[model samples]
Target: MFTRNGVWAIISKDKIKDFFHRFKSFHIIVFFVIFAVGVLPCFILSRGIVANYESRAIEQRIVNIKTQCEIIINQMGMSEYLDEPSSEVINAQLTQLANFYDGRIMVIDKDYNIVKDTFSMNTGKTIVSEEVINCFKGIENSRYDKVNNYIEQAVCIEHSVTKKIIGVMLISVSTDSIVDSIDILMTKAYILQLALSLAIVVVAFYVSRRLSRPFAKISDDIAEMSEGFLNEEISVKSYREMELIVKSINKMINRMKVLDNSRQEFVSNVSHELKTPITSMKVLADSLLMQEEAPVELYKEFMTDIVEEIDRESKIIEDLLSLVKMDKTSQNLNIMPVNLNELLELILKRLQPIAAKRNIELLFESFRPVTAEIDDVKITLVISNLVENAIKYNVDNGWVHVSLNADHKFFYVTVEDSGIGIPKKSQEYIFERFYRVDKSHSREIGGTGLGLAITRNAVLLHRGTIKVSSEENKGTTFTVRIPLSYIAS
Candidate 1:
C-alpha cells in the first residue's frame, strides 16, 4: 500500500528525472568546458615541466664532468701525461669522478691511444669516435639518448701552462637516475591531475544545478497554475532573468483572471436583461387572458403595454448584438473620410423631436470645418448614443449642447447636457457593460445600459479617448478626441 508520503516521494523522483533529462545537453557542454580548461591544460603543462627538468639536470651534470676533466688535465700537464702517463694523483681523481657518475670514463692522447680508463677494461686500447675527434679539434660535443637513457660528453684536455688542447676526455653516463627522478615527478603530476579533474566535475555539476533550478521552479509553478491553483503569484527571483520571466507570467495571469471575471459578469447581465422584458410581456398577456369580459379600451391598453415591452426587448437585443460585434478583436473597419460637422448635424436633427418631447433645447456649435478617417456606422452609433442619452436624461426645458472642432492631428467632439449627472464613484464604471448609475431611473427611461459601452468601444477602435466630467444632480459633459488618420496596427 502506498501512503501519501510515498506517493509524493515518487512524484519528486519523477520531477528530478525530468529536470536532468531536460538539461542533459547543457550538463554535457559544461563538463566538456571544465575538462578542456582545467584538466587538459594541467596535464600538458605538467608533462612539459617534467621534460624540461630532466633536460636541465643532464646539462648540469655534463658541465660538472667537463670541469673535472680540465682539472685532471691541468694537474698532469698534458705534455707530461702524453710522454709518461704515470700520475697517481690524476689517476685517483679520474676513478673518483667515474664512480660518482655511475659510468665509464676514458682519456685519449693525441695518437688516439687510451692513456687512462676508469673502467680498467679499455686501458691501453685505441679509442676513435666523432665526439673525441671533434673535442681534439677544439669543438666540444655532448649527446643524450633518451631511449637508451644515457648522456655522452667529450671535452678537450688542455695544458694549463700552454692553454692548448692535447688530448680528449670522453665521459658516458647512465641517465637512469635522472629518469627515475622524472618518473617520481610524473607520478605526482598524474595524482594531482586526477584530483583536479574530480574537482572540476564537482564544480560543473554544482553550477549546472544552480542555473537550472530557477527554470525547474517556474515549470512547477506553471503546472500548479494549470491545475487551478492561481491565487498566489509566482515568486522565483533567484536570477535577474528569472525575475523578468516571473513578472511577465504574473501579469498574464492577472489579465486572464480579469477576462474571466468580465466574461461571467457579462453572461449574468445578459440573462437578467433579457429575462426582465419577457417576464413583463408574460404578465401583461396573462392579465388580458384573465379578463373574459374586458372593455375595448382595456384590451387596447393591455396590448399596447405588451407591444411596448416587446419593443424594449428588441432594442436590448439590438444593442447586445452591436456590443458583440464591437467585442470581436479582429473586426474590420469600413474606414473613410467623414465630415464631422455634417455628421453631428444629422444626429442632432434625428434627436430634435425627442428633445422637443421634454421641451429641451438641442444645439450644435462648429468651431471649424473638420474631416477625419473613421468607421461611419460605428462612429454614428457612438455620437447618436451620447446625444440620445443626453436628451433622455435632461431636466425639462434644459439644453443639450453638441460641439465639433479640429486640431492639426486630431478632431474633437463634445456633448454636454443639463441632466442628472452620474455619481463620482459610478463614473469610473459607466463604460462597463450593463452598468447603470440609477437602475430604477434607467428602467423608467428605457435605458439599455449598453450605450456607453458601445460608444467607448467605438471610440477606442478609432484610436481615440473619451473623458466624462460630471457632478451629481448638476450636469454631465463627454469629450472625444480621435486621430485624423486610421492606421491599422
Candidate 2:
C-alpha cells in the first residue's frame, strides 16, 4: 500500500522534525550561539569595508574634478572668457577634464544662463535652479546623489583682481567605475565570509558534540536506571558539572534504596502485629470450645484472656492511628502558653501509679519556673510517653529523675532512668516506627514500638529536638529542648 514517493516524503518529514529537535538540544543551541558570535561581525565588517570604499572613491573623484574646475574658472576670470563665452583654451581644458573622469562641466554666468556646456547639449540655454542661484550669491556647495550614482559640485567663480563673484562652475562626475570596484570587493568579501562561516560551522559542530558527550552519557545512565538497572552507579567524571550531577543522582538512588527497605519492613511489621492478637484469641476460643460444657470458672478465665488479647489489639491499632496522624499534623497545632514545670509534674503524677507497680520511684526537679509556648496535648503525649517508657523499662526498685530547666530562649526537659540501656547500634534506629531494640523484651513490656517515633514527630513539630544517650546496664537519659516561643517552619 506504499509508493516510493510516499515513503521518501515520510522520511523527509521525519528528518525535518529531528533536525528541529536537534536545534532545541543543548549542544545545538551552543553551536548556533558560537556560530552567530563568530560570523555576524565578519558580515558587518564586510559591508562596512564596501561602503567605506564607495564613499572614499566618490569623494576623491569629486575633489579632482572640483580642483580642475577651479583652475579653469580662475584663468577665465583673469581673461575675457565669460564675455567671449566660447574661448577655445577654456573649452578644451573643460572638455579634457570631463572626458578624463567620464563626467560633465558647465559654466553659468550671473544671469543664470549656461554660458558654456562641455557636452554642448544645453549651450546658450537659460537655467534658474536653486543651486545655480545660490552659487551666484557667493555660497559654494557640493552634493553626491548615491541613487543617481553621481557627484555634483557648485563652485562660485570669483574675479581675479576685484575678488567679486562673477559666475558658477558646476561639475558632475559619474561613479560607475567606483561602483564596479565595490561590486568586485563585495564578491570577494562574500567568498571569504562563506569560507569563514564554513570553518566556524565545523568548529562549532566538533566542540559542541565533544562538550555534550558527558551529558549524553549521563542521560543514558539515567535511562538505564529508569529501566530497572538501579544497582549500577552513574560515574561520568569528564566534567565537574557532570560529576556533580552523577553524585546527586547517586545520592538520590541511595535514598530511594533506604526508603524501599523501610517500606518493606513497615509492611511486614504491620501484618505481624495485627495478626498476633487474632491468633491468641483464636487459640483461647478453640481451647474453650474443645471442652464439653466447660466450667464457669474456666469460661471466665478464657473470656478474661480473650479480653486481654482484644485490649492488646486495640492498643496496637490506637498507636498505629497516632503514628499515621503524626505525618499530617506538622501544619496543625493548638499552640498555647503552658507551665512546663506543672506539665512535667502532672505527667509524673499520672505515671506514678505505673512506676509504683515496679516499685520504681518517680522524682521531679525544677531548676527554674518555666513557661513556654507549646501544644499542651501533644507535648503531654511526648513527656508522658518518655516518662512512662522510663518507668516500664526500669529494673525493680529503679528510679526515674525528671528535671526541668529554662533559659531566656528555650526550655529543657531531661528524663533519666536507671533501666536496661540500648545498644549503640539500636539507638540509631530507636525513633523509627516499629523498630525495637530487643524483640522479646519489647513484647514483654507491651510496647507497640511506635512511642518514640511519635515522640520524635511531636518534638519536630514544635521545632525542637530530643536526644538519648545510654550504655548497657547504665540506664538511659532523654533530653528535650523546646523553644520558649514556637516558630512555624
Candidate 3:
C-alpha cells in the first residue's frame, strides 16, 4: 500500500489473506501498481531519449553525405569534360565512385535520360518510373526503402557548380550502418534496464526482511511466555511502535512472574492444609477402634466426630474448586449489602458450643453497625473461618472477641482470640495457602491451614483488605476492611 506522500506501507499477512479471500487479490493487484510507479516511467523516458539520439545521429550522417556530394560536383564541373563526356568515360567514373562509396552511383543527363546505370541493363528488372523521370525537374530527393526485404535507399542530387546545373547524380545508400547503430543503443538500454530492475528487486527483498524481523522475534517470545517461561524477554530492533509492543510484552511477562509465584504458593499451602484433616480422621479412627471394650455411647460420639471431619473435608474440596474456577474464568458475582455485625453474630453462635467445651468464653463487642457490598456466601466463609480458628486455638478460660465498625465508604470487622500468636515472620506467610505457623499444633487443634488463605481470597473477591496483628504468646487479631460501594452484585 502507498501513503499519500508516496511511501509504501507494509501489508500484514492477515490483511493480505483477507484481501484474497474477500477483496479479490487486492495486494497482488498492488504489486503491478508498484512496478508501474517505480519502473515503467524509466523505460518510457529511456525510449524517448534513445529516439532523439538516433535522430541526431542520422541527421549528422545526412549532412556529411550532402557535403561529400557537393565537393564532388564542384570538382566535376571545374574539369575540362564538363560539357560533353564519352559513355565509356562516364561509366568508368560512375563505377569508380560507386566502388569508393560502398554504394551504387548513377549519372543522369540534363534531359532526364539515364546516361550511366550502376546495375546491369537487363530485361525484367526494376524499371525507372515516372517519379525518377520527374526528379530531373527537382533539386534533390533522398529516402530509405526496402529492396528484396533488405535495407536500401536512393539519394538523388542535382550536380551543379557556380549556379550552373550539369547533371543529376543518384546514389543507392546502404542503411546497414544506421540500423547497426540503433541496434547497439537498444541493446545497451535493455542491459541497463535489466541491471536497474535487479537492483530494485534486491533492495525490496532486504527491506521486506528488515521489516518482518521484529515481528518474528515477538512471535517467538510470546510463544515462550505462554509456555510459562516468565523470564523470557522480547528484544526487537524495530521502529517506535514495535518498541512500544516490546515494552507492553515485558510488563505482561513481569505480571506472569508474579502470578506464577502466587500460584505455586497457593498450591503448596492447600496441600498442607488438606493433609491436616485427613491425618486427624485417620488417627481418630485408629484410636477409637483400638479400644477392645469401647462404650457404645463413646463409639457413637466417635462416629459423629468422623462424620464432622468428612463434612469439613468436603467443604475444603468445594472451596478449592471455587478458587480454581475464579482463577480460570470470569463469573458474575451475587452482590448485596451484608451486615457485618449480624454475620459475625451468626458465626460466633455456631461455634459457641465448641468454645464452651474447651472452657473458652466467646465474647462480642460492637457499638457501630458495619455494612458493605459483598457476596454473602463468600463473606460468610471468611467470617466463619475466623471464628472457627479463634475457638479452636483458644486457651482454657480465654476469651474470643468479635467487633464491627463502619464509615461512609468502608466497613471493618475484627476477630481476636487469646491463643498462641503467630510469630512476626510467620504472620507474613499466614495467608499463603497450606501455610502453617505451627503445623503440629494446628493438626492437634483440628485446624486445616487453608482457612486464612480462603478468607483472604474471599475478601479479595469483594475488593477488600485483610491484615493480622499478633505477637508470639500475646494473642492475634484478624481485621477485614471492605469498601461500601463496590459490591459483587
Candidate 4:
C-alpha cells in the first residue's frame, strides 16, 4: 500500500514481499517513508530548479527587449506625422530596431493600422500570422512558452509615448538545446541511483549470510543430536566468542554422555555386587540342609564362609558410600607439603609383606627427591589401590616397580607391573566407575571396581593428571603428575 503524493509510483507486490521478509515489515515501511522524504523530494526539487532557470531566462530576454526599445525611442523622438516622408523616416528607425534585436517590429498609425512590418517586407513572409495578429490585438504580451526548434523565448511591450497601447514586441529563442541538457542530467541521475541501489542490496545480502551461516550449521547439528546421535559435536569456524559458545555446547554433550554411561554402569555393578554374596549364601544354606546329619566341622566351616560373605557385602556397601561422598564433594582433603619420595617409601614398606605372600618382587626406584603439597591420606589411598591391584593380578614371582621423578614444574610418580596388561580398547574406559576389562577375572580378583575411579577423583582434587599405558601380556604403567606447589610459579 502507498500513500498519496503529488505523483504516484508503482512497485511490484513480489518485490515488496521480498523486502519485507528480508527486513521486517515495520522497517520496510520506514524505509519507504524515508525514501519518499529524501529521493522523491530531490526529484521534485530538480524539476523546480529547471523551471526557475527557464523563467529567469525568459525574464532577462524581456528586460533586454525593453532596453532596446527605449534606446530606439530616445534616438528617434516620437511625433505623429501625417505625411509619407515623416512616416517613412519613423518606419526606417523601427525597422533598424527590429533587425538589431532579432524581433518583429511594426509601425502603426493613430488608428492602429499597420503601415510597415520589418520581417514581413524584408523576408517576404506574412506578418499577420495567428500569433502576430493576437499581439496586434493586444491580447498577447510576448508570451514565453515552448516552441518547436527553439531553445528559449521572450516577449516585451512597445508602448506609445502617450501611454496608449501602440504595439507588442515578440522575441523567440530556441529551447531544444536547454531541453537536451536537462534530459542528459535526468539520465545520469537515474543511472547513478540504479548503481547505488544495486551496491546496497549486494552488501546487505553478503553480511546477512556471513552472520547467519554459523547459526544455521548449529541448528542442523542440534537436529542430528536430537535423533539419538549424542556422539556428534557441533563445529563452527568463527571468532573467539563464537568458538567459546560452540565449545560450551560440545562440553555439555560430553558431560551428558559420561553421565548416561555412569548411570548404566552403576545399576549393573550394584545388581552384580549384591547378587554374588546373596547367591553364595543361598547355595551354602541349601547344601547344609541336604545333609541330614551335618558334621560339627562342616557346620563351623559353613558358618565361617557365611561370615566372610557378609563382610564382603558390607565392604561393598561402604565403598558405595565413599563413592557417593566423593560424588557430592563431601570429602575434603587436608592438604599440606609432603615429601612424595618419603611417602612412596612408606607405601612400599607396608606392601612388602603382601608382595612376599604372592612371591612378587616389589621395588621402589626414585631418580630424585620430589616434594609436593597434597593430602597424605588421599595420596596413600591412591598408592594402596595401585599396589593392591599389582599384587592381585601378578603371577608367582612377578615384579612390581614403583618410581618417582621431578621436573622444574611438576612431580611424577609411576607404578608398573609385569601382570596381565589391559587391552587397548579398555584403556580409555578403565578409570570409569565399575568398568572392568575382564568381568570374570575382576570377580576372581575380588575388585569392587570403584578403586580406580576414586583414585582418579583424588588425583584430580590435587590438580594432577593421570595416564595409563598398557599392552596385553606385556606390562601396564600408570603415571601421575602433580604440580610441586598449589600455586605454580
Question: Which residue runs of candidate 1 sit more than 4 Å off their true CA positions?
Answer: 1-45, 75-143, 286-299, 329-331
Please tell me which model should have the higher lDDT, number 3 or number 4: 4
* Alpha-carbon runs more than 4 Å astray in model 4: 1-303, 324-333
Model 2 Cα shift for residue 366 (angstroms):
4.4
Backbone clash pairs in model 1 (N, Cα, C under 3 Å; residues 3+ apart or in different chains), count: 0
Report how far off residue 376 is in candidate 3 (Å): 2.7
Please list the residue runs of candidate 2 whose C-alpha ends up more than 4 Å from where it truly belongs after superposition: 1-32, 63-97, 108-113, 126-142, 153-169, 191-257, 277-310, 339-346, 366-372
lDDT string for model 1 (1-489, tens) is 569889999999999999988656655666667668877888899989998999899999888777877777677664487657777777778888888888888888888999888888887899889998898889999999899988999888778788788888888888899999999999999999999989988887787667777878888999999998767888997889779989999999999989999899899999999999899989988988898998999989988988989999999999999998987843689999998888889988988999999999999999999999999889999999999989887899999999998889999999999998889999999999999988998998999999999999999998899999999779999999999998686
Worst 10 residues of 2 by lDDT: 61-70
CA-only RMSD, every prediction? 8.0, 7.4, 10.3, 12.8
- Rank ordering of all candidates by TM-score, starting from the highest: 1, 2, 3, 4
TM-score of each: 0.82, 0.75, 0.56, 0.54
| Model 3, position 307: C-alpha lDDT score | 86
lDDT tens per residue, model 3, 1-489 = 347334323446556777767533333334445555667877997899887876676566556666666655565566533345444554576676666556775555555555555764521233365445445455365554533212222334434445455556666656566668778998999999888777766665565556566776788878886776745577877889989989997888788779989878777767766776688789888988899899999889888888888877887787688666555432556777777778778878888898899898888888787777777878888888888887777678888888888788888888999987888988898887667778777755755567787788878877899999987776889999988877534
TM-score of 1: 0.82
lDDT of 4 by residue, 346-421 (tens): 9999999999997999999999988888888878978888888878777788999998999998988889999889
Pairs that collide in candidate 1 are none
Candidate 2 residue-wise lDDT, 1-489, digit = tens: 479889999999999999888679889888988899999999999999898888888778877777777789889889877777767888889899889878888888888788888889998888887788888887777888888888888888889998888888888888888888888999999999999999999999998898889989889888988898756788896977778878998999989989999889998999999999899999999999999999999999999989988998998899888877877877889899999888888888888898999899999999999999999999998998899889888899999999999999889999999999889999999998888898888887888888999999999999999999998897999999999999977
Best by TM-score: 1
lDDT assessment of candidate 3: 0.70
